[model samples]
Target: MLFKQRTEELNMKLNALAQSFIGFSFIAALTACSSSGFERTNLNQANQRYHAILLQQEPVTLNSSIPEGAVTGASFGLFTEIDGDSEDMISGMLAGALVGSVISAVTDGSNQATRYRFYNQKKGEFSVVSKQKFDKNVQCVEVHHTNKIKLYAVDSEFCRLTREDNSVKAIYGGKLQRIGTNAWHPATVIVKDELIIAVNPTSQEIPAGAQLIDGRGTWLIPGLVDGHVHLSQSGSAFTRPDMIGATHIHSYGDDQSWLIDQLPSLLEDYVSLGITTIADLGGPTKSLHVRNQLNCESHCPSIISAGELISATPVPALNGAQGPTFLNTETSAEAIAAVKMQRQFGAKISKFVFTSEAGLSPSQLDKLFSPAINEAKSLGQIIAVHAQDLDYAKAAIRAGADILVHGVMTAPVDDEFIELAKTLNVTYMPTLTAYEHYLDIFKRQLTFSEFERQFGDHYIIDSFAQLNENLSATDQMFQLFTRYVPFVDSSEKERSSLTPQEQSIVAQLETLFSERILQIQVANLFTVANAGVRLGFGTDAGNPATLHAYSVAEEINAWQHAGLDNLKILHALTEGNAIAYQIEKKQGSIAPGKSATFNLLTQDPLQNTNTLLAPALVIANGNIIDLQENK
Candidate 1:
């Protein structure tokens, strides 16, 4: 009977609580339909009151020593006293609802929750407010509930809220709660605009509505640098609509009237292949003309042209021979005139031929070439000479040649020559591929079948016939006259009476002669590279069957085959080349505040040398050139 009477009395008090305010029962019914139910209204009111305290006329300074009554007043919106004790319950509920709603609104909208403590003067103890968001649009603003509103103070962002039945709800909101040293409990985090953040599987929490990018399961490394390549060649290759095997032929000298006519296509081809820069050895003045054309086009690679060849003398028999003749010059004045003529033609480096076996005296050769080297220095141009024999090589170096185009073949490089080259900082470009090609021809071996496959049947027939004719002429004429038999008038007449079968045998023997030249060239190259000479890469482009630019990789592979360290080979391709060309400041290296040029590899090249051949991204001047689509 006593329990039933107490229940009736509590019911009457609850009815009185609901009847005290207008629309109070309607608000309670709406709350019951929501997820938070009755707690929604109370939480909303609590948020409003919290904002009111935060937006007070004066800033509320919080510290460790605050009274609990003042905190309760601030949290429960009890700024003014009520008329009666029964009115206190009604006012407290309204204030708590208002504060809770305002707090929830602020925390939800901004996505940041903070823990704070305030002193309540009426309760004589500290009170804590913890903010937490339960959904995208809603936040739960919780207040520590106790017998007298406060007894213990909230130490951090974490707080325990107690209900009338003694059930506890641990509230952690506002700032993310740090659970331990360097460890934080996950909670809603707020991110502001214009802030940079790094995300990993750690204590740092991402705020609600924050943008994120997944970087998991991936590694970042430095980009690649392709030291030698032909960008104009690449550009041209890509521009063509029906480019199939045409690019291959274009890479060598095509039948086009002007090689410069192919510059646009070449540039596109280079960009497509991720060749951001190139060092063109020699072409017609047409190389310079093509360079000017590429200057106006987009996606062109950086090009460094050596202009045309500056030979020992203009010999119509040799390939790509042009410019003023350096032969027949006996005095320094004539040699200086030759240098001036080359400079006027805009040669970056003066190239000359020095061969003792070519029938020039040491004194005459010195007077003919040394002045040109001196004149080049006066004009601040580098000297690159093609010297075949040891005497010529030594003379070229002694004449201050900056680059030795061919390796020393007549004899092993002496220590004196090596030391002198190092002292003068002279570079060597050992055209090993050309030597290899010569070897292939002499031995009757096919070095590159891919080249033959790409050029159709008609081209193959023509090329083979041309090769046979050249071999026949060399065997019947030059070889016999130069080596086997002296070109006596009577002997020549007698040799002419030989049959076609005998001539064919002589043609076959001609193969052996070419092979010997190639063997000598390779031996010379091996000697030079092993002697620690400064070496750079060059494809000797426009030569028959030699792959342009792409030959750089092959050269490195050959060097590795000869037992050089991979890092040393890479350095040769990158830093060493830069030093060789004196362009180290503008190119090379993956560093900040430099030109944003780099080659992207599909895999780490450090692990495998073959990775250098992989096709991937090419970034130049801060833009990614699309090679896949162009190809």
Candidate 2:
């Protein structure tokens, strides 16, 4: 159960709370400004819904200036019949129907003499409507409730009120894994709504009526942040036609529709895996629409997104009719316009696909990054570039990119590049398994973990088991669609009739990238890490066989094999993510003034890292839903 709290702590005269939509399971509660000792005294059968609490015999606050309760007000006044001109607070409080439902409902069905201690009143008093007036200045909603919530009278004094204390209980006795410092200390955390009120030592006294959630024997850590993902693809066999043109089998349109329709569930999958934030690097314009529609929702991860990429290599999927969902190469004014359009549609980062071009002079670099990077900076956005090879990555780094979306796998990242990365403060996201994922699917060697089988999208997971049977195509054809050097310059029509020379180059480029690539990627990852360049943990999920939530675990195993210590890996997932994604502050830390979003692991992560995948409880946006079903 989540405790809903009043926003203000100052003396507020009164506030009211109407019943919120029944979707969220919460009980109505009346709490004091500071002290908490209230306990549920009433309960009905189904779901243990508590209606009222007994506070008379509980520990009361020494101060009498604080109000005992408050009412909820809203932007909509339709229920109040208030004037349309300005937001009418009086309309909500006039009926007494506006507030006090949590403390006591009107037995008469509409109006009743409810008891409440208003604005430092000595005791609760029975009252009825004595006067009615309109006041636009009074900030009386729980949202707006504060010293500014002016004293109003629909009845005599000591009736309606807003209180703050004990609204949410202190989370006691968790070994708080302090981010930035590898120290775990016993701490008590208290939250009010979404903001953390305090992070006191375990020895500190909790407020009297404050409810307590036992967190002993658990490690409390900030929620994980996956810095790379894609919402356009669903990690299904049918999700990406551009990579493998199985249009005869892959219903590209229906798959896109399913992605939009099942977005809520997809987001929940991220949450279940303890990822509270994701950065969607690039996709079609519809990605912006998804970000616009679902941003800041309680259950969904906070998203950092960009529109279609400014591609150095023209995407073969750029045709509009094939549900064009990947990169698009636009230049000069058109490129700047595309960046502007992304910002307008909630794109916080500008993405570029900077593939290495043969014999391109140094002066030609501007054509790849161009005014897009400059324009993105002008609009306060950072640059994220997809550069796989060392030369291309260096070009991107020199172009002032803030993030490298993938580890350089074509060759080892050298010391000069490492130093350059450190100087630029560029974050490196080693999507260690994305290419391997495509190979797995193509070779019919794709497999899911038990955890993935339990929690991931079954349609996608099951499709992997039956990929070849569904496609009725050879591995070579699938490989041809997933481009190489020669394929990048040609159209699908040309691909159908490739010259023998071009085909030879494709085979050569494929071997160069495929064989020993993991070793190269891992060597680059740790070199950057050892040099103190920021490291971000990102599984390029939504790629074939790279299941979104499940891939995180897979990537973690890869990191372990790469010899990244547990502490470094944890930091990469959290604080390193903060640096890479350009978050304002430490969104990946557990401390005061931080977002009250974290996960509870059954054991200390430093000792038992497997626990990270199985969060015992997930508090996202300050509320815990049923994440157990995923496990």
Candidate 3:
């Protein structure tokens, strides 16, 4: 008789709770704190009980500290309150729905008689106010329930409440911290949503309910950025076998088909190497389509591109490729139209290829150069000029080019050129590693440093290993350009006259290789960088053996070997590159209002730049990428 009376009482209370929800409106639950006050307490015993009930285990014993009034039964108790904002109530509702769903699934209505009470205080008395199932709210908040376990909660199924993540995430206990302005301190990088909200010193307490990433003894630094790259081509000889020696100098064939197919793998390769952003200097007009196709806040690195490269008619290197294949223009009007068209195609920057064997006439140069510079400037866009030689570089500078995509590789850079570049505020991309690609391929051997071995893409390394094993310098197909052949001497008369043995001997001569030229270029780069000239981080990745992910580390190590300070090298890789790319406003730093993109290193990169070769964790736009999983 007593059990029947209790059952009737429980049904009456539940009915009242359900009725309280009707016509009250969700607006009434907008902010639970809107009520007069709250006496928040953390009840460990209540949390224990809640988990036990959800796990379908026997209810845990409650501590005496739990108020007798709050514990109606062994399975029912109030948990210790964790501090939260207005979203806490929503979190509570989501969590309640989570528990209720599990209970409903396991019990199959046998436990339907069980009563779960929710309370809110008014007039100093806790009362059963309402009960409602969690559902999508009209205010852009959706609760997605998944049966799979999550990183945050491994033992329990996750019910992800997708609202703007307003809670702070604290990365604490780092022995070393690197933030914007090159400040290194023992600080926690606090992130909320997509932005880095703060970098508080270790002295501060981690915010309640904030997501915690235990840095422990690791080093925290801003994610690295590769200032220049080309997504249109894969960084392999298979994609561009002609790179070995462009003897034919015909169109680069149809890369669009393969480019569209391999875009995901290319982007993943870069992001896995801790590269947060890549500036695609030049590509086909359809480059914009590729950019649009993959652009998103996901695992991929951010891609900014110059949709197409504008070049003068009769570009010596391209042979006779024209139209969208090479965006050729001979008049100022055509140049303007080309720039505008590229912009229309969603180009973030303007790229002009200034290539000439004898240099263009003054008037001809002005017609091709002036309009592109003027149009890009008027549109507030920076121009990346591909200048292969000092003369062409000078022409680009005169045209007010903002960035020189390559150093003066044909000859040594002089003080006059350096001063001119500095005065014009031109950023130089030495692309030192780009030369090594040709050197390594010609030598019929591929090598990597210990750091590269660890961090480099296994796919690229394995591919090179296979190439090295299958091919040798004696192969007839490789002999076309292996005999120290000069690229510009269109007449192959010199190579044709050489006997087979003589050609083999010429190919064996190490001095015949242009690797020495690259060394001189690196010396010039060091001089220019030390002289206060701006140098951006670019390895001309996508060039033959300058493999995307591996080359970034190799490039940094190259600079380090050239005696650049680690901090300055880091600055160039991060902020300086961002500035050169004109994206510093949104990226390049661990500062408030900047994207929460950074790398957690197992070791301090400041001590050894190669420590960045493989990041322990790469956080891009608030998403943590598992480097190992991707590898």
Candidate 4:
């Protein structure tokens, strides 16, 4: 009898529970229909409340610190529009429940009420009100009497909102809240909509159709900067395929027609390799044309052109020969005249060649450098010199050259030269890779087999070989000079007369001479850079066996061989180069508001120096150029 009674009681309780659920469902449906009829008035009232809140709260200054509590209150005040224009009691009750639901969804504990001080406009004073924290996680607060709604949000946290139609919504901190899976929410909440319902704590499932991104495990870093390059010179006549070590290919005689014809394709190639910028040491006229072309295109690397070279009025003859057209002006006046000519052609910097071939007397040399310097100063441009020997370098410095284009090779640079360069603040573009390339070819008979494999074999054997052969007699003379140096002293005469075994020693001496020359060159470059002198990297491309954009990696490698830290190498490519070009303020760093120019490498270059050669994602002028498509 007792067991039967217990069973009957349980059945009765189940029936009552089912009946209660049915009644609640019917009431919810009726509420939805009633709310739909009043949607327009409710929305208008919400907008009015939002406008009132905005008028009450002044715009906050960005980047300024605000008290956390004050920020919370301000954010909540911004949500006043959620309460529709229903009966005051009904609106207040509904808005309170919504806020409560949100706080509950996001927070851990039960609901609690707290007192808040608000500015009462009508009374022109502060008033105390009781606000219950409906849900901690949702940040819901209930306004006791007023039919008003408000929501508060932190700057970076993610939040979910519910719409009037009982649909869920997701929103980022700034703008564009995501639409929830349920379409019941009004379409108005798609983007830029003010209606947001604080999600309930139990709602852990993502709203239908919400997109999520995993930002918790990743970080964003600034890109890499490539300081110097010549896009037009990469695959040109002087470049050979086998020269794997050549990084920069400086083109000497680039013209408008040639650049116009070649830059489009060349730029496409560079963009694919993540070269974001190039400092054109020569070929300004054509460079301008190329820059214009790139600007016309939707995306391309930046080109900083240095106009034409500002050599003496008559340029020096190569190897003291009269084979090609040379500019050799007699007086300093002629040099200044040449600078004026280049300036008129829109050159940004003056480039002059200080060489022994011009054979300018000391006084004339002084005059030549003076006028170029003065003109450059007047125009606010830098004067860079293609100085090869010590005499030319000293002369260029004495005349106030802003940059020394090549490392001194003919003679060792002394303390005095370094001091003068420091005093004058002259920058050095030590095309060390170029020197190394020449050294390898002359001493080791290294050929461009590797380079040819990438660039092509036909250019190497046909055009490149012909060019090298043209210089064969000059090379022979240099070889003969080395052979005769050993025979100068009688003490060395016996050594020269030695048989095959002694002859091997002579060959070793020749190798030593070549190595010593390169060491001397590196020493001078280091002296200048170490003595507080600025340095830039360039590949003297357009010469035989030089690589193009890829030469930058080799330059970094060479610097490491010379004992520079990886950071210093990076500085050379970034801040160092920016300073050399006088544009450090705008493009060198990843700081805010700076040009968004950077490289996306697979690894950190500072950690593993070889990472410099790794493929990267290149961004220039705020756009991601299609490297894969171009490749």
Which parts of model 1 are misplaced by more than 4 Å? 1-258, 285-287, 295-298, 318-331, 449-532, 613-615
Candidate number with the higher lDDT (3 or 4): 3
Local accuracy of candidate 3 as per-residue lDDT tens digits, 526-620: 88788888878887887766776668878887887777878878878887888888888878777778888888888777777767756777888
Candidate whose TM-score is highest: 2
lDDT of 1 by residue, 140-259 (tens): 223335321222223222211211111111111211213112222222111122111221232233332222211111111122333333222222211121211232323223433333
Clashes of each: 57, 16, 5, 36
* Ranked candidates (TM-score, high to low): 2, 3, 4, 1
Prediction 3 global C-alpha lDDT: 0.63
Name the candidate, 2 or 4, with the larger TM-score value: 2
Query: CA shift at 51, candidate 4, in angstroms?
Result: 32
User: What lDDT is obtained when candidate 1 is compared to the true structure?
Assistant: 0.47
Ranked by TM-score, the better of candidates 2 and 3 is 2
Report the lDDT of model 3 for residue 618.
85
Candidate order by decreasing lDDT: 2, 3, 4, 1
Model 2: residues >4 Å from true position, as ranges? 1-167, 178-182, 295-298, 316-323, 357-363, 470-476, 479-513, 584-586, 629-631
- For model 1 the TM-score comes to 0.55
What's the TM-score of each model vs. the native? 0.55, 0.68, 0.65, 0.55
TM-score quality measure for candidate 3: 0.65
Alpha-carbon shift of residue 209 in model 2 (angstroms):
3.7
